[model samples]
Target chain A: MHELTTTRNNYQIDPVLTVWGWEIPVYLFLGGMVAGMMIISGYFLFKGRQKEPTCSCFYVPWVSLILLSLGMFSLFLDLSHKVYVWRLYTTFKIASPMSWGAWILILVYPVIIANIFIRLPKFVTDKFPGLEKYSKMLTDRPRLIQNIGVANMILGALLGMYTGVLLSSLGARPLWNTSILWLLFLVSGLSGAAAFVHMVAKNIYERELLAKADNGFLTFEIFVIGLMFIGLATSTEVHQEAAQMLLSGSFAPVFWVFVVGIGIIIPLIIQLFAVNHKIQHTPVAPIMVIAGGLILRFVIVNAGQVSHYLNAHF
Target chain B: MARFAMVIDTKKCVGCMDCVVACKTENNVPEGYNRDWITQEAFGNFPNIQLEIRSERCNHCENSPCVSSCPTGASHYHDIGGVVLVNHDECIGCKACVASCPYDARFIHPDGYADKCTFCIHRVEKGDKPACVSVCPTNCMYFGDLEDPNSDVSKLLKSRKWHTLHPEAGTNPHVFYLT
Candidate 1:
């Protein structure tokens, strides 16, 4: 049989082509989750102990640490020469968002680690006196820790929003450049954070402990999802192209199945059942909501990057 | 002072990519890399078609987004003739400027520096035309000082109907293409 042949040029005909692959979306998801967790934890920390400090406060630091490390690792993997990536910090430039993000992560990581260490149980702390002393030092200076937490919150918020802005700044890539992308990213981040917390709580805590933790986060996530949809629908042509991909283009199946089906609608339906049954205090609904939120982040990040500017014209 | 510029006559261009090869050779552009290239838009399927071929390169814009986005001041417009050049020593290779360029003019070189068409600044400084202008078989590429009335580029600007890529970007690129 004669072979069907297609010749691909070494040269890219499209000027807007990018080498930014899976790393970009991974970075976005990680940044969103980190920002979300930091915000939720900061809110609870500043507002005093919630119904369950074990799940909301103590678990958040560990989860944030894991996500932050994973995201940073993925970022390194995205680089062409991953070994030389450390040089980015030495010759920093303020105009580059990546540079800004790199510095922010450096500052944020240690504080998160410190926060996590301090909140550990006395048995663990007593076994390691040096660690226990360090924990005590941070706890004794509550104001310093508070300031650190506030900075983390503000920086985390920017980190979350900046991922969208980073994409938006490429005005030529009509798929990315938009004023509303930042808000969409922020809402998604919060949703991802809520989902992550729900998952972690489900894995670690008993049924009684889960019931004590607030289920209100599900309602908040639904509201945010609605806002994200509205923002996507009303944006400009480039953004419309990206949004359309979610609705009907190559990204539609994933967007519909994962983001809408699993993340938004499923959680909403589950929460409705819980509320109607007067099971507002239950953990099952929030757990489902959180699963949906994680899946939403996965779908959006992958979908956003899959469609390129040149692809739109062709 | 003379403002350096290029004038391309699209009708004369055969889409041979001679200029693309000439540019890479002159610039020491890395293997599997390019400093300039051509794009073709063809309509109405094979055997009943019309084609438009355009040479593409960094425009050396008056308001270059690449320069603005470079966090380390590595990519900057030259003071002498407004040619954009990257300082290899200072570039962090974050590829921010690469992403910022509207025409996809810039690339992150293997040496971890942002690289693009410099309008052959070294040759221009030595009173020579860009290699692409000198090497083009059909005489499609013209380079000269835009400020001098006698210069070919300036005269062409006055005489021909021309356009630059992405005029809406307000970069006022030095390169002009005759349609």
Candidate 2:
């Protein structure tokens, strides 16, 4: 009899690569959610709804600022050298998606900050009497507000797509190498944003409209996921094996249960019924969608790391 | 103008891991980490099986993904022989290069920089071989300018059939193995 042996150093590469921890997924989820918020706020502003009392444009921009900061913080924590993060801004590598993201984030601050002034709350103006002039300056110029809307939408889409492209560009990881991943992330972000606005907007019309939009985006999200799997299944054998991780492998349960069932399908069904007025609209559906979006990020990031180019051990 | 390349004669390798230890000692690599290692692969039925042992490290590929993916230009080609190296001060410890490498040749240094084999660029500038190639006792490794047809590494490739680690990756890896 003969024995065969293999060694995979733990401190080195192993059954799989696990360089990213919870931080990446948390950052990805928050970034995507913020992307969705920007698009929703931009769309509302373009329609000249900033004057309306229930318009979420006023709240979303400010909220997005805080949420994005949190997300960026998580991303910063993931860095091996946190102090040198400033180095990312020094030069732009056209081949690097992370560079695009850093620059996009820089643009996000000014645009979202400008949006907050379009409908600066009276309480804030009252506290800082000197700020009234800038608020009036922005609110008086509808055309300027509309331009910021276009900028937000454009930047929003870029931010959303950048999250997915970030993963897809690393062709070394078989699970993230699909062409459809960008669209999937963008749609998921849009869906999450729609659900959030539907939950928070006080106007009956706005809530109903956002509910309808949320349903549409969720349905599109399901389709995009199907296409992503189809693309993966048809790729090389290694890619197909990589897809197996999310399908029937160890990650299958979380993928099918938390992400697909509770996170997506149930919320999707609830929103569909609420949009149709077959059931009363509740916050449950939107919350589910948000949570599902987060879980999806976790599952994909973890599974992608486990899906090796040379071996499908996990 | 020297495109430095490495040629490993697998049949001559003993998988002693002298190369891994030498890299640690020479580079002062962090504890529980190394810049190179040995791999043993076997094929065929038990009695007729063929065992191939390889001492592997960073390929320092021509189309290096790690360099291209680095947002801060920390991972760049050195002047001596286009050897890939990470400037410790410039690296942000993002690990994007680590993920981009198909060979999994990198790890995060305890000091927060992406760490990997540099082909001993520091020593090479002084006209010394890489730690691994220099310490290899079995004489299974060779390093020289592949662009120079007269070089020993290039001559070995011309005389013997060789294969790279992941040609389909399109990395244009500079390392080759003689089976």
Candidate 3:
């Protein structure tokens, strides 16, 4: 070229933009997984699958409370002004994902409690006979129980979508800017829930049923993730660079190897073989699915931070 | 209503980082954190390189993502001059704004709130310039009400060929750089 004169701004500052840490990703992962668990249990209740001894609907609510509480605790630790967190509930912001999530969580507690009450296990009734009346009333009213199941499904869907929307609405990170992120999160959440059920179910039929469900959800999750990447890549240069961060840049190895390879692909293949009876089912694949789900959130959250507009050399 | 804005002349910038120091001292930024910073772009090969030193900070965008991302309305646009400011008491340190800021301008102060360049609101409220603008040795920084056509920043924008940090992001940042 004729007298090459290139202009670039290479001076960089450390710790300039970074703020979030491990807490956020952990919160997101747990929240999505819990939402998935709620949906699975709700669907089972709606379908009257409670007759099965190993029905996930029996214990998912109780387990969800513990998991969600842990997630919330992690979130609480991230807040600088933990005492002022009540301010978030003082007002409802239609535009804020955090506000919506707060209200959804408030509603989720009652639904979860009702779910557990309606499907109280024998150990609980045996130990505390006094609580039998409430359980009896819930069990007696089939229509009312089904209605609660529907409510759980609706609320669970909202919670699942809200987790991803929380990050995507920020619009600052191109990797999170894609509209399909919420869908990917929802599908992944459902897959994790299915895998969780597959691992814990005592009934072989129920276990196989959940394993098959997990296979379907995992496939759908992969498709949604592909869409998310495509959506980002086809957008502006900044978004394209953001996609590259996951594709072949610094985050590629972890994303492809850990998240995609070890987390998803291997599990999907193994599960398919297990379902076809070509191989005996092991908890390894379902466990991998859960681990993959968690890693997916970590990769997305951290990679989004690395993908910035200014850092990209246009 | 006035719209506050800052314009930096890259040609005049020495990247001495006086602005960064002044901002930290004036704002009492926590240790290991900053409210403003500088970025240098050097291009070309060998001795024939073209270098551009940019003193950067929060763009204080007209369409601020931080404002919308904040659930408690802690990060808000000041009606007086369109300055993006965070109310520390109301902020829960959720870091939503920190993650959403395309400019990477915000940080979680040790005090447990999101903070960024406020354009020295305390000084500006007293009819004074921002600390960084007032302390620039090369006079490369200009801060004024863009709403006032006669203001220094407005005049500079009109007279100079300027570019914002990320026009593609569509945040409509108030900070402009004159090449």
Candidate 4:
């Protein structure tokens, strides 16, 4: 016979850091990626580059709908009262970022559909005679098509910035309470989208153009990230600690290895070399960019939760 | 037109966690989650150390980020005393309020909506004290309408030296701690 005993692990409960989880960062990643794709697609359409098979305008809207739906599904999974999700549209609270996001998404669907219509491939339009009439309406009015491109660009930019503004407005998490977060997220989205297009581009000229654009966006992203750190470090003590979470604390490894090293710098260096013909273009760089972009959101969301006003140290 | 608040006397607190237990029992707080809890902090070095015990919960802020961040008006102020309450029926469980709260007072209830201390409004409405206040062995917790000068909380504020958690966060918390 043996005496039975129970053992317990003595982990302190962090009361202030319990509300959010993994679903948030995944949703942010998907939302940002969709915004990026739309912007790329919009720009190509605005420039009247629909003839190229590799032009994002041809397939971006279809792809965007699928990606956005996936992102919304992730968000829906996070909700506790899934049946009550319809209540979000009952009325808009102007102060609420969540409200703005809901409305923006509603607006996004139609714009994406119109964009897809604008760039409808001939084979499909020929198959459906009714679709050709609508496609012709877009082709007949160059200004209408241009206005649609502008609308997508504006909507896409707003969607990208909203993802960051959503976090920054929290004010509770020092890591997220920065004005620079929106710019960083938007630029990251653009770069991510550019990398995605670069990978799938069938035309050499389009691929090269996107590669160059991604490189530019990457450089700007580095600057925005640096500015964010500087802004945080210069603020109150708690804000400094929040910034340190990325600079030297628990999140440092992820931020440096995944976000900065593999995500930004490696891809940047590869693209630079490829541009000079020192190396051939490979999917490796673009894939790394996409991975880094996703990791950036994860790091921000997770690390932001860990950063708070009062804890054991206080 | 009442503005309710809680004043906790840290000196009288024994860290026995009775208030925590009482709150859970009264509120039916889910397993592995808490509506209120205790936090212990040790200040100074080795021999000169001062140990502090705090009973922490939602401040029900006058400038609550959670309220403004809520998309569907699920998190709103009650009409009677400006108490922040959640309409679970309207909650989409987006967790915007959870992230926006600086004190980290709110949690996603297992039922899938944002939940937190209601200051025991159900009891307060019935002219009863909150469970934590009624059960505190050390008599450390004080609750009343801050707008009423006759209320015990207002008198205590007038007599004691008190501070709020994270004043710099600027939510202007209704909860106060007397050193």
For candidate 1, write residues B115-151 as lDDT tens digits. 8898989988888888888899999899887888999
Where's the lowest-lDDT run of ten residues in candidate 3 chain B? B103-112
- Cα lDDT tens digits, model 2, A1-314, are 23334443636356568889999998888888889989989999999988797788989998789989999999999998988999999999999999889999999999999889886788998899888899889888999999988888988899999999999998888899898888988888888888888988888888998899988898889898888889999898779988888989899999999988988899999988888889999999999999999999999998888776676322
* Cα lDDT tens digits for candidate 1, A191-297: 66765565455434432322223234445545655665566567654556777776788767876776667666666566555545555534455555555545555
lDDT tens per residue, model 3, A116-172: 998677898899998989988998998777887888888888989998999888777
Per-prediction DockQ comes to 0.29, 0.58, 0.44, 0.48
**Error of model 4, residue B94, in angstroms:** 1.5
Considering chain A alone, report the TM-score of candidate 2 relative to the true chain A. 0.96
Encode model 2's per-residue lDDT on B1-179: one tens digit a residue: 89999999998999998888898999999887767877777767768988888888889999998998898999999887889999998999889999899888899888889999999888888899988999889899999998899999989999998999878888999989999
Q: What is the C-alpha RMSD of each candidate to the true structure, in Å?
A: 5.1, 1.8, 3.3, 4.6
Report the lDDT tens digits of candidate 4 across residue range B108-137.
777778889999999999999989999999
Residue B149 lDDT (model 1): 95
Residue A171 error, candidate 3, Å:
2.1
TM-score of each candidate structure, all chains considered together: 0.81, 0.97, 0.92, 0.93
lDDT of 4 by residue, A96-212 (tens): 988999899889889889999875777887788788788889978877877888888999999999999999988888899999999999999899889988998877888898899
Q: Which consecutive 10 residues in model 1 chain A have the weakest lDDT in total?
A: A1-10
Flag clash pairs in model 4: A80-B112
